[model samples]
Target: MDERHDPARARWAVAGLFFIVGIVISTWFTRIPQFKTGLSLSDAELTVALLAPTVGALTGMQFAGRLTARYGSAPIARVTIVLAPAALLIPAASGDLVTAFVGLLVFGVVDGIADVAANAQGVAVERQLRRPVLSGMHAAWGIGAIIGALSGGAAIATGLTVLQHFAVMAAVTVVLALVAGSQLLPAGVDRSQTDRESPKRTSWRTGWTRRVLALGLLGGAAMLCEGAISNWSAVFLHDELAATAAVASLGYSVFTVVETATRLVGDGVRRRVGPVPVVRVSVALAIAGLALVLLGSPSDIVWLAIVGFGLLGAGLAVLNPIVFSAVGHGSVQDTGSADTAGAAIAHYTTMSYGGVLAGPAIVGWLSGAMGLTAALACLLVPLVGIGLFARVTAAAEPAVAD
Candidate 1:
């Protein structure tokens, strides 16, 4: 069968890699305390070590566009998946804080490269297939997180050392990535290029540049909501609602499941409601969900958080794809070659990741001082703003070709 008709299969392949990624990233967090104990590192020292991933991600984002352009996304993705497991080994085996920090730094680089490649592939596939398929690709990442969290918990409970658990996960990730790499299309043919005609290139300095920047900022805000939920939802359930271990953990799990399901359905939602209206509706749902989490009764916090996160997921789902699609429009006009579309993907990704790092740190500070409930309440502000911008951006959107 022609690949365009079967893009879902490609998405599934990508999702499986994301699943391994989830295990690698989340499993280590549970082992953080154990690592600190083993390494005899101070909290301040651990905090500095933890920043390795963010720093690495920022650095990787700067060059991923050119790397993907030159080497193609497939090679970068395959290599990253193979190397990601190595990151898990260091902290698991280390007797010193420095080793653990080195592990995280390496993990960060692997994660960053994989992230850029996967998203570039997603955009390329979606444009070729001429449908909104990126959300489902992301939904795979959410599913992977659930798997990671559960696996990590089980390993911890089973008395498996961090090293042992990570080693197992690494082996699994390497095998899966290698298998998936076989199926992925070459980025050159896989990518969308309207024509081979080379047009004058536009720099990121003026004209629609401001608009692109604005879109990036808005995209970053959406990412903040996602990052915040991932990092802090469990803490909120535990401290605010007084939930038990199993019950509290459900906060993130429930959110992830709901988010994944809704995202699978997001393309349909956009097709029926139109992209702008869907975004508006999603933002409203997020507000309601946030309100429910902050003000709902103890019996309902989990369900409320689930609903809010679902709304958050659904609402935020289309933003990234839509933003890239918009950038593709600009690039096509400027460069007369749609392959340059991936550059827009790079720009927006950098912007969104800025929020990915900042969101957790910001909320951690708020939760420390003003409390979790207040931090959750602050999320509503961005949701409301997204609703407003959805209207303006929707009105301004270039006509979608059939």
Candidate 2:
């Protein structure tokens, strides 16, 4: 039952699940403007409705760790992955703002649970592989996003209804989830159980260690940047840069393609340069990219925004993998139980979800008050924070115990 005996299968399964997650999320994001118009909502009204998902995600994060700890990640992943896409149909078919809010709330809860389960599986597979495969697995997600954005754009151009588009996406995701779930390691190989049997169980209190919090903060900032780009890039292009709807969709496609490419090589980069330096450089690139986005909006150079988004995507490519890997490596103290490790990951995930949940609403509010350009500029605060904290915290990563 040891997954290490067949690490290759486990790795592929985990990667595929990550891909499905990406597709589900990106499909919803790329169609946000359509939803707004269909519901006849203002930017601020849309922002308010969007908060429903954040509320659901926060609620789901509270319990996903414990559920994964008790049930094993594969089973939890199978159920949540299936439920996430099915839930998407609700919002896609909604005729009113209230209905959309309810649907998004359901989708968010299931999606959040699936997110935690997938990462747990990824960490487990990485431990079995005995190398830096986490980043490569995350790259699968970027690939999925690229495909989703491009396809969604095409579907819209061809006059596909939102309901019809979501139906197709849900079917595809369900099929992929079933196949990938079957290939994951059996329940006996659960990483959480293994940690629970360690000689020294890491106390609940140590789960809040300063190093863990710092890594969580860094990860949260990175997720915020990603959420901003995913949810707003199309809108930014159409509204600020005066691009057409079809052309605006290409903005997200460009960003995701670059992100996928960067993540494809992220594992090698981390091995050669170490995580801290990688994180520092990545944040710096993001800061520079956002600056270009701000400057390009008014200058009427759409290429600048596209190029800047690509750089931003590249910069964020490795962030989640590095942060998750640090948690796995640092959770090696003899005193730590599998529950302790799960708790640590949950804490980190909660912070990251906070950023995701808040990012779109914050951007919408700011854009309504000022302009989209000024709204995006606020990302510099978190980007700067990532640079300052990346090295110091990553340097403290504990060696994983054999």
Candidate 3:
């Protein structure tokens, strides 16, 4: 291996990529209200616009595995990361629903591809290190999200326009992506060659087996909860709860801050207690957190809702990382080839992104019909589903290097 592919350096570089993704996503999420106002969209119309990204992400995930296999994860990630920030400018500058929809669609496709590539890099690094570091890498994402949310909230308070905030964020993201991307591992490790050399090779069909699908489902459940909160908590606070824009943004800030704090210690916990138990406990905590929000909503107690959001964030912090790590660690039996892992990851990402696609629209439609309170309370359903499927992660074992 090249000195540049040193596990330590690669780990930090991948963390940096994850951090940049987090920043761009959080920056856009924090400005959802601004987008809504700028377009003068109804809740239903906003739901329709949000669906654009979901569609783009699903479309991108279909091709991400092939792209990663053909060109390597690094180059694909580098291009997408640079493109992602630029795409943000589209929606931020949009003065109508059509433009916002188009902008979000482009941004979502780039973001979806970048997401899989970055996680593929993280999985590769973890396999090299032969330890649990995925949780910690994901923590960097939480840290970036916290910073983005706080900065965006402050910018809104100080009279910054959507274009101004997005432009600065985009420039910062592009610079960081180029610098960090240079440190990623070089791409040419072929799975076919590895399979020829190994004692056994997993068939491609193994990547879509029941166990893998179950793990993907668990991951999807987590993403759905996270997506809903990221896209709606601020809206819930600002509009439904009648909070000022600054205070509304704090809901997301508090959530990400607590989530980040949990992730700081998540790796240690995973190594100690193992992934299954951690997931079960996380699901339980998430249920409790959402219950608090449900309880608070009825009483108009903003503080309670804020605290609940914090707990929800903490519960969700480790889930996707754990699922991704499980996939990298040969969670699917006989599926340890590099290509198999990449394919499995693409499948997992597709399922997870489905949740993201459904979340905003579900919240929007339900909130429009019943009420935001009832809409949010519905998150409890999926949290329970996660607990039921927690055992799937236990099947994973460390990858056997080719």
Candidate 4:
């Protein structure tokens, strides 16, 4: 155990919590029909109601920066794990829509908080280890998602009901997450910032004008790819391929499995290629993935789409942490305070999270209007956009060495 490191085991614990949260959130999508029926909501009304929870979520994400900066990542992360998993209890217990909405809102808050704080913790842990480790942390998150999705069938089969089931699972998972995350660094402490006039004096404006914009945009595009799959993959499978709900989800399931596996090995891949090449390769893979999905037929080519999405997941997995790493390095290069890094991270996350929140609905609406094929083709624009951005901003600009 590296003495300066925040116990690798502890970080893994945090990783597990984040993974469970991912599972619960994704599972909720499957449960939306039940939610709609329970609430007696029409399609339009359901959409409207769903929007409210995201509103709360976005608001929480926006403020997550200030909260973490002041309060620290570990405590906030702990609270979010508890809060988010706890939110499961409400929907599990309630038979009505109003209560479900409130539960979702709570879910949103925990989601935002856990996401920001965990990333923050990952940064700290990475610096202490003095090597690339974030990919593995994210891989753990993906694995958690797989476990959650797999369990959904069992939960339904057991006949305990969604509410009762989610509540019990929530309580158990949150406690485990809290226990696992206890020894990590506090949120705002920067292992990379040794030359200190104190980090708190730093401001966001100074950071954004630097290369942080490119980093933020890149992170955003990668996030958009993920959002696209979660929201549109099932639709594409169901409508375009005429598959069952279970089969339709196979699209995302394959993507998650491949993505998780790649991420598990991504650290070595990045080490061999470097950030610029890794990003370039990943973006190219993403473009190919999206293209394959667009062109492939359900009868003979659906597996091709699955393969494409899997490649896309692996390609995209390295990005989120890489962006955060770049921001931390930028601050060091500029000889700026670590607080600036926090602000930069906050900005990048804002763009990335916003993309995810918006990508599905936007894709869905476009699919409704122009057809699923056309909507899938629409995704190509962003892929091209991201590719061009990566090429132009290709150089990592050499970390401003200490």
Candidate 5:
């Protein structure tokens, strides 16, 4: 096969960008302690500082679609990946809290834009290949996170300064960007044929129709489940379930391991059964898992909660992929809008971030009021919502009764 223009090559290129973003994010957060010490930020200040990326990311997402439609997924993805690691260096070398905030904010902006572009490029490759590759691409991100964490630890253990560590990572990312840029899709590949002549002003109505936002709600709900598990699993295990400290740590590791492994093979499952069945089953599994987590409290079996957490990871492994891919494929049509698929992808992604923000806070607030298990149990409602909305990701929409 001539590899230069092969869709597989393009797929790998996009996947590399996803991997790069993952590594950039994981590296930054893993080294956050250094920022705290170096910048001498108070606890409250640190919490506020941590929010910079989320705010920046949301702001960037608003522009991602227009940027992609104007240029293309490849150019934007390539530019962002190259900038992402360098953005990390901002915080790494920041001399004050304000500077660190600015650095992280920039990093988040790059991250938000790169996310939509890379995924749009991946969807384009999947269209060319006529199969599901998004799952594996996402799985690549999970793998990159593991590698980033390990490498970040290695950098710390070897006594490298934060700036030096980030600089090396940035250098490596720039070098890899050359290879990714060479093979990623061309500038107009993911854009619509009519997009070039369409009026440049994109009103929110373009892709923010009912269905896309509905899909966003579904995606957001799933992400809330994820955020809960990732942040609260350990706390739930140790504090609520009376598990050992070592056991508590295992909860998230198990969730991550299972989630990544499931994603590696999830594309095949989606291909075999179709997305609707996959999503329905996924939500059921997540609900079942959360149920087990709740049951562990009454039965006092911590292992059930552990297994439940793994199931939650496995269940959610491909949901966001399915939601994003569905939007990219235009499976759900809406009112007439000239928005490119990239724009639509960017639109729903904002809601996804909203879920990420709400999850931990909702859980914590409920934990304080009703208790931890009950707070987690509340996730069931959204899990059910996911299953109910599974058809949004399917090829055919149910006909409306006039």
Candidate 6:
């Protein structure tokens, strides 16, 4: 990295951006109760309204590729810097269902854009710095989520309204994001930063080649499991396993801690082992973890479920990072595509969130037909498939950047 680019600073900037994105989204999650109460919404109505973000997010991601391809990651990231944080006001600053839905839809769109753009920026930082940083960047997001949740708790305790809490956080996020956005690598660095041979592959279509598609599938599968586990773990423990609500809550808590811890150390592990080994190991752990869940399902054992969720977190923690790194590095080398990596990352991210959005609904449908046990057990199918296609992405991970 050139002294002018200040690769180390740029890396932190991206990390900060990641945190900003995570915290803003988490802020929304933490306030669902307020939204429900303030709007006088029924449970079913809230569920339907919550779907707006997912739909809007998908729409936003579909266009982010083209936007980044034309304007570069830095510019798009800066756009998110303003839009995502500021858009927080939309969802809760409403009086009617139609208005709230529109607000959330717009929020989801901007959030989706921010998600892709921030990741693309992270990729640029990795390439410019010539090492692995994506995991750590993701770790920042996790950390931010923790803070967001805690802050939300505080706000609730202090009797702040939803709008008041969101407004304050939104302001803070915009200020912080501006600082981070300023330090992002200048436009075009994602394409220009390279230490390896390049120019062999041309066109953004390279983003959708078989290898990239395979990586996308793997990422989607992992996130699908995450969505299912996150949304259902407590329910499973409380209802299926006959645990107390307090104990049931520990399921997701364990998963979150394990996932965050794994992400914290994942970069060093990836630096030592290659991406292939990292992914392969992830596949094994995820499968073993889910198997443990199945083993405990026959009986009402809460500890078994808790342990299973922890392992599942460990297994799923690093796969998405690996996928993102592979796609970003691949695009850097294949400079022929204007934003080949951007386009590809957008697709991968879209599929990933789609998995999360769809996972719960899919499980619900399956549960109706075959019971929740069989439904969750069905996740193993994708985990095994992830193992089969682990090598598709050409991720020859480089050593840690100094």
Q: lDDT values of the candidates? A: 0.68, 0.78, 0.81, 0.68, 0.83, 0.80
List, residue by residue over 1-402, the lDDT tens digit for candidate 4.
434335466557656766777677756665667667766778887876687567766667666655555566666777887777777667656666677677777777768767777776666555555556677788877777767766776776776567766776776786677676666665445432322335554434434644777767777777877898877887787888677788778888788788888888876776676777777787788888887787675465777777777777777777776776766556545544444445555666777887786678778889789887788778777776766776423333223222
> For candidate 2, lDDT tens digit of each residue in 126-189?
6656566778889998778778888799879988888888899999989998988888866544
Q: What digit string (tens of lDDT, one per residue) describes model 3 on residues 221-251? A: 8999998998999998877777789988888
lDDT of 1 at 144: 74
Query: TM-score of every model?
Result: 0.83, 0.81, 0.81, 0.85, 0.94, 0.92
Give the per-residue lDDT digits (tens) of candidate 1, residues 149-252.
Answer: 78888988998877888888888878888787766656563233322232233333212355567777777888888789878887887777777778777767
Off by over 4 Å in 3: 29-51, 89-104, 150-168, 189-206, 231-250, 300-302, 331-333, 363-375
Candidate 4: count of backbone clashes, pairs at least 3 residues apart or interchain: 2
lDDT of 5 by residue, 6-85 (tens): 78898888788878877888888788898788888899999988999998899889888888777778888878889989
Task: Give the root-mean-square deviation of each candidate in angstroms.
Answer: 4.2, 4.3, 4.5, 3.7, 3.5, 3.9
List runs of model 4 lying over 4 Å from the truth.
1-7, 191-210, 241-247, 297-300, 365-370, 391-402
Candidate with maximal TM-score: 5
Question: What's the lDDT for residue 12 in model 3?
Answer: 90
The C-alpha local distance difference test score for the whole of candidate 6 amounts to 0.80
Which window of ten consecutive residues has the lowest lDDT sum in model 3? Answer: 190-199
Lowest-sum lDDT 10-residue window in model 6: 192-201
What TM-score would you give candidate 6 relative to the actual structure? 0.92
Model 5 vs. true fold: TM: 0.94
- Write one digit per residue (lDDT tens) for candidate 6, span 1-402: 455468789888889988887788788899998899999999999998998988889998887766666667888888876787677687678888899899888888987888888888787777656678899889889889989999999999999999999889988988998888888887775442331234433333546766567677888888898999999888877767888989989989899889988998998888787788888898899888888877887596668878989999999998888888887676555544435677788888887887887778888889889988889999988888888888864553532332
